[model samples]
Target: MEEFNLQFSTAEQCLKVIADEKWQEGFECRKCGRTNYCQGKTPYSRRCTTCKTDESATAHTIFHRCRIPITDAFEIAYLVCGSPKMSSYELSRRLETRQMTCWKFKKRIMECIEHGAGLHLFDIPQKSQV
Candidate 1:
């Protein structure tokens, strides 16, 4: 697998990258079938012009409702992706988060990753290191 070096000079940059990747193809309204709604001007907000359902861009991600700044979330994602295996305790220490919070975050992240495991994007085949 290729390594990805995360580069974000600012929280805004990280959020922009995530938003671009998540909605590269554009966003569709959950309420209606319209595909014309543009991303909201707010940093973390997105609005559906068709249904007027304004939503946070991070509404469904692991960072949803998280008190931590978006930069922390980006750092967490990077660390999780890069590590081969990590326990909640280890993650907590690395991220300077509470153990309980780490546990919860780990659970949700693993669930999300598992749910998408079947998809080709996350279905990386195991390779034997020579």
Candidate 2:
């Protein structure tokens, strides 16, 4: 793995990164399948121009269900990815998050990596019947 600085200094920067990754070309509405959307009230979301549906930058990604700030979650994920042996306690102390939250995120990340699961960190899986 390449040593890249994944630490985002601000929530806006983090949201931008997520948005860029999610919509490489441009914003596309998931509901109406249109390429037009308006800036949403939240920094991490957008509203479709056609269907008026809201979309989150973290939607359908590993960070989807996270309660912490997206930037903090990204930081924790980066640390975990870089140092697989680091414990949840250390992570909690470093990130100022709950140990259980750290553990759950780490567990999910490790499981995805170890099992070659479709939900691996970066590779978004295609839709399929389970």
Candidate 3:
């Protein structure tokens, strides 16, 4: 958990990283195909000026619709990527959360990592950076 804390001490910090990675190239409205955007209603969200579409840092990424706190989810990703041998049981214990929850998130991370054969944390650096 030291690494997780070092990289992201809070959920807001994690969201900032995601937002920076998501819009690294620039913002393009998913709905209007426009590049103009503004601060969204929610923290770390981007709202398209042209179409009034609001997108979250978690949207269209691995963290989308995650049930746990973003901080926990980020830690899971960090641990799973850094130590592939870790089990969900260990993860749950570390997080002091439900085993099933850790298992589910771990499964999702594995699926994404497998989907992009060479993927790891911060790899490929295109749209999704987790």
Candidate 4:
């Protein structure tokens, strides 16, 4: 795969990238099926215009429930996707994250690719429910 030149310099930038990519084809409210929505206080959240329900950009994505900064997670995912041979230790060094965290992220990404199961790191599927 070609290397992606995404600028994930900040948490907000990463969140915006994820949200735009996830909703590129357009998004509908899970609760009311409304196409319109409003941005939440956080860059990674959105509120439905119809039902006023809040949703996270990473809700159904591999980044879901992640404790690290979105930019760090995005960097990890990008590194893994771009260089499958990269070691977790190397990734951890590059991202300045804990080795265990890097290992877990790498393992999860590898499992997704090897099994071709669920959603891959870059493939953020829209959730059916918030």
Candidate 5:
């Protein structure tokens, strides 16, 4: 895996990289399948004017719903990408955060990757009674 500069000096840089990856062909309306989306006038985020579908640059990503700072988030991604076999607790230790938070982050990252890999949440098997 390619190593990224673990540090993101500004949130703008993080958003730029995320936007480039998520909206490579420009913003497309998820609801109407139209390429007529534009940045929202409001301070919230972007919106699809054509279909009225709204989205954030962080939508459908591990960074969504995270309260951690952008720099920390980038660090988490870097850690995960670099330490493939490390445990969640190890990650928490490295980040100097709670183990449970790291666990949640790990799970959410897994979910996002699964979604990217075309696996729906419904397709995930439930735990069976032993």
Candidate 6:
């Protein structure tokens, strides 16, 4: 069995990384196409000044609507991107989560990779706000 080398251990750390990637290109409000933003109600979130719509660091990324905690999701994403062959059973043991959950999430990650959207969290193509 291969060793699991997870990159992020805490949700806060993962959120910071996501936030950096999310806003590195500057903020564009999903609604009204405005670039102005303000501090959001939550950390790493951006509130569009024009539309008053708030988006989180994980809003449109692969982490969007993630069922697992951010830390677990990050670990899964890191490991999967690192070695795409690892079975969900193996991931379940490593994460101490349900195997089915791991399988479902792993499938999602694999789909992104299969489509060439990205191999890592930062590389995953975020869905444009519609």
Could you list the CA RMSD of all candidates, in the order they appear? 7.7, 5.1, 4.3, 4.9, 6.0, 4.3
Flag clash pairs in model 6: none
TM-score: which candidate is best? 3
Whole-model alpha-carbon lDDT for candidate 3: 0.81
Q: Give the candidate order by descending lDDT.
A: 3, 6, 2, 4, 5, 1
| RMSD in Å for model 6 | 4.3
Query: Which of the predicted structures, 3 or 6, would earn the higher lDDT when compared with the native?
Result: 3
Please list the C-alpha lDDT of all candidates, in the order they appear.
Answer: 0.59, 0.73, 0.81, 0.72, 0.61, 0.79
lDDT tens digits, residues 84-113, model 4?
899989988987888888887777667666
Residue 9, model 6, lDDT: 59
In order of appearance, the predictions have TM-scores of 0.71, 0.75, 0.87, 0.75, 0.68, 0.85
**What is the per-residue lDDT of model 3 for residues 14-56, given as tens digits with 9 covering 90 to 100?**
9999889888999888788999999999899999988899999
For residues 1-130, what per-residue lDDT tens digits would candidate 2 score against the true structure?
2223344767778777877777777777868899888887778688998888898887766667667876677777778877889999998998888898888877767755675743345444423211
**Candidate 5: where are CA atoms >4 Å away?**
1-7, 41-44, 111-130
Best by lDDT: 3
How many Å off is the CA of 92 in candidate 1? 2.1
Which has the higher TM-score value, candidate number 1 or candidate number 4?
4
Q: How far out, in Å, is residue 106 in model 2?
A: 1.3
| Stretches of model 2 off by over 4 angstroms after superposition | 1-7, 114-130
Q: What tens-digit string does per-residue lDDT give for candidate 6 at 16-61? A: 8899877888988877899999989888899999889999888878
Question: What stretches of model 6 exceed 4 Å from their correct place?
Answer: 1-7, 120-130
> Residue 118 lDDT in model 3?
31
Pick by lDDT: 1 or 3, better one: 3
Q: Which stretches of candidate 3 lie over 4 Å from their true place?
A: 1-3, 117-130
Which lDDT tens digits does candidate 1 get at residues 6-120?
4664677766675665566777666786777766767856788878887666654455665666665565556666672777788778768877766665555555566674211
lDDT (C-alpha) at residue 102 in model 6: 88
True-vs-predicted CA distance for residue 45, candidate 4, Å: 2.4
